[model samples]
Target: MKLLRRRGAVSLDDRLAALEEAADLADGRLEAAAVAGARAVVSRAGARRSLSVDHTVAALAGATGSGKSSLFNLLSGTALATVGVTRPTTSTAQAALWEGAGSGPLLDWLEIPNRHEVDGTAGGGPEGAEGMAGLVLLDLPDHDSIELAHRLEVDRLARLVDLLVWVLDPQKYADAAVHDRYLAPLARHRDVTVVVLNQIDRLSPEAAERCLADLRRLLDADGLTGVPVLGVSARTGAGVAELRALLESRVADRRSWADRLAADAGAAADLLARASAGAGAGDSGDRAGAPRAAEPVKAPETSADALAGPLTSALSQAAGVPLVVAAVAKAHRHRSVAATGWPVTRWIRRFRPDPLRRLRLGAASAPEGDAVGRTSIPAATTVQRSQTDTAVRDAAAAASAGLPEPWAAAVRHAARSRADELEDGLDRAVATTSLGASRRPVWWRVAGAAQWLVLAATAAGALWLLGLFAMDYLRLPEPPVPTAGEAPWPTVLLLGGVLTGIVLALLSRAVAWLGGRRRARKAARALRASVEQVARALVLEPVTEELSRHRRFTEAVSEARDEVRPGRG
Candidate 1:
């Protein structure tokens, strides 16, 4: 009998734990109303516990002419509640207290100003039924009452009551106002809810059975699949014992309040789960061997690998890396030509500005400020800027695609959060990267020494030729000039020096061309590497962080929905 009569299968501790878990699940995903409602459930549960677990508050509620007050009186075995055919007879809530057991604070919170005491020993309710001594049965005003205050009173008591006995008549059993507005909202409370077909005496047994079956169908459609429904006549006492026994069972159990609260939490949690189910849909696959819900939600998956390449390319272009590379090659060629070319023509190379120095870039002896300073690199053209914008948004979109609402937006924001910093970051990267153009190569110095030696030889040879001409003009004796092959000594010296200097200059120019190209390629690679780093730090980091946050939110909501296993609790 004890097992059969227990109102809830779960202990109070278990139910409370489930409620807390559900509240945790609803932290960020649910609507404001749902979060507030869950908090209210927890708050009310705590308040109810602090007041009295010994007292069970049950309310009998119905339409204006449903005989709910009469049923309440019958259950209490006293005419504690007003009963009449007048519309909205009970404007305020009335309570029938039993066994002189006090529930003052609980009733006050319930706002039941009218109270009546019942003789616990009268009517021989049942032997060994002393456990129901703390029952407070309330007869509430009609939910469909003409008076707005009466309906408001019903709403208030219905939310607070530990148990609810909904009284209905054959005539109004299918009332849309009652079913839609009242019963449907309490679908979560089916375990603590009872549906009574009152005024059964007015119908034949077959008609009453048919009405009860129809009500059961309606309850099922309302998500109250397992709720109990009974047919009773308050005047004939038919099925009244069953209703009273059901109430007594609930009132006897101290866990009924916890069960009611659990139902409320579960309902709130379920609604929140539905709200967020579509969120993070394309996130990632399930965690590696991690336990999940029986039917787990699909998580969102995003990869920054694909985004990295395009992002780096865009940044490289925007930072003028190509122009820098070209400058590096040209600078190398300019310096080489100045060092190894024929000394006389080398001055011509000097007049051409060093390409790197012109751009304020890669000068070995430049000031510290020059190395860290912004370059004369041209601003990115409109096409380049558009490409960069498209790259950033595309990366964000790809990573956030199919993610649930809010989290998807969050990821996108994280990706673009640092967009304003991109141009400056890329510029800084370009400025700081070592483009290898600053260092003068050892070969350039050796070649410069060779060029000076050749120029000196050419100078001495020209002087000898001029001295030969001057001696012939003045009829002076000429110094001995050694002849080679068919050419005169002075003429050979003059022509050979000129031809050798010109040949060395042409060879140096050819070497500079090859070395310049190689230098350009090396510098471009180094600069682009720097650009990639900036992209990762400025763009990828934020998006990854947002995705990580989305993952945590998903786990929290999943745990809240599936962790406790409400049925076990």
Candidate 2:
């Protein structure tokens, strides 16, 4: 029954502000039907507040022949509403203002053209308006009237009035139409509702008490257990003074308007909470699934982290990071062979293509004058695309696991907001990554230099031997040669030079192979880092922002729910 029973130190403005914030935050994240009541409350409260807090508008409503109009005349001390000549006598609402002159604009807003000025003397009420100065009492048309428009009039005024007096006859007080259609729904408005048993003068005291008891039972079943119920006879003036006193007190307090409005806001806020909170609560539960006003809801698993892992994997394949890493390794080995190969065959290695350059992953692969551009990596295929979409939707589902359908849908949309840019972004990331393949290792250069020097020595030794042969054959002088032991210097140089070059080349090849693999692993790591950045921009960040909104929305709803609710007794 806390349908907006606002109780606490919170001011009216603060409560309304919290409600407004919730409604605004809920716009796209909650269903329209769920938040519609909230919007209406805000509007109605604003209008009612701007007009008057000094006045109280109370409505006397009941089925035809219940003497509701007679009671209205008895309390207000005027015959503003017609009394019992025919059924459906009051076709429209009639207002009786205790502070008559100043309430025209308010009555106009209420659309009650037939307003009477009550001097408080006509019905044996207090002699002046001082007893109920700011009361605007309405005698609404008969709710049970066969005339459709008369019934419609009663229903219309019922919602607008600050206080409700459900006048019932002894015979029909327990009727289902009255109990089911009006009292049951207004159970939450108990503090501002009153039930009067009219025509009780016909019953003896014992009979009247019994009727009152039976009526209370009916009201309790209608969920209006604590609502005020009294016996009054408009024809005999029995208990009319008591009814007048009740009305006067409510008007003097001048809180019924605010209380009524607060009740509305609470009901609307309750609905909003349920809609935002996920579904699955049953009938005895809040049908829309109530959101708790407790501590903020936490992510069991962070959505961004959850989304990034699979997205990064998908993007890596899409961007050709694997291809680039492979090229880095092959290119490193290719360069390695050139750097450490036999001098005679080193030139042959140049004819083979540089794997990194062919894939455009190397600096040399950057076009002669263009930007580090798109890679030669294949586009993401249908299979990869499907996997990526699945990952995003799954992440959304997890992030919004317990949320209502509307909020979950919002999270999904946020996840996919930038999905279309994934492929291009990942490709750019791959292209600009420094795979470290183009740069040569320091050892390669040193080994290459050593190979050339040995080749030079080998040529010199061959030339020295040729010179001796020529000298012996054509009468030329021979130069002296040095040796380590018995071997001539020329022979030693030739054998040592050829042998050293081959051995050095073999040793360098081993080092270069290990270095190439290491560099390839390093390149793979770098490319992955780039892919992660792309995944974050294209996928994870949007999810994070969506979650942020969700947190704020929940917090706002909680504030409305937990803070001092205004408008309760």
Q: Provide the lowest-lDDT 10-residue window in model 2.
A: 280-289
TM-score of 2: 0.84
Find the candidate with the highest TM-score and give its number.
Answer: 2
TM of each candidate vs. truth: 0.75, 0.84
Which regions of candidate 1 are displaced past 4 Å? Answer: 1-57, 94-119, 122-129, 133-138, 156-161, 251-253, 277-300, 334-375, 404-414, 445-516, 522-542, 563-569
Best by lDDT: 2
Candidates' C-alpha lDDT? 0.75, 0.77
Worst 10 residues of 1 by lDDT: 284-293
Over the stretch 165-195, how does candidate 1's per-residue lDDT look in tens digits?
Answer: 8999999989888887778766668788999
lDDT of 1 at 433: 76
lDDT of 2 by residue, 1-569 (tens): 11233455445665677778878877877767756667777888888877867889999998888998888887777767787758877788888888666677778888898888887565455554677788888888889888998887777778778999999998898897887778876755777999999999999999999999999888776667788889999999898778888888898887898778766666566667666654321111321122221233434547566667777787677677777777887788888888888897788999999897787668744554566667777777888778777877777777777655666688789888987787778777788777777677788888889898999999899999888888888887767878779999899888999999889988987887788789889998988888889877767777777777777776665555544335543
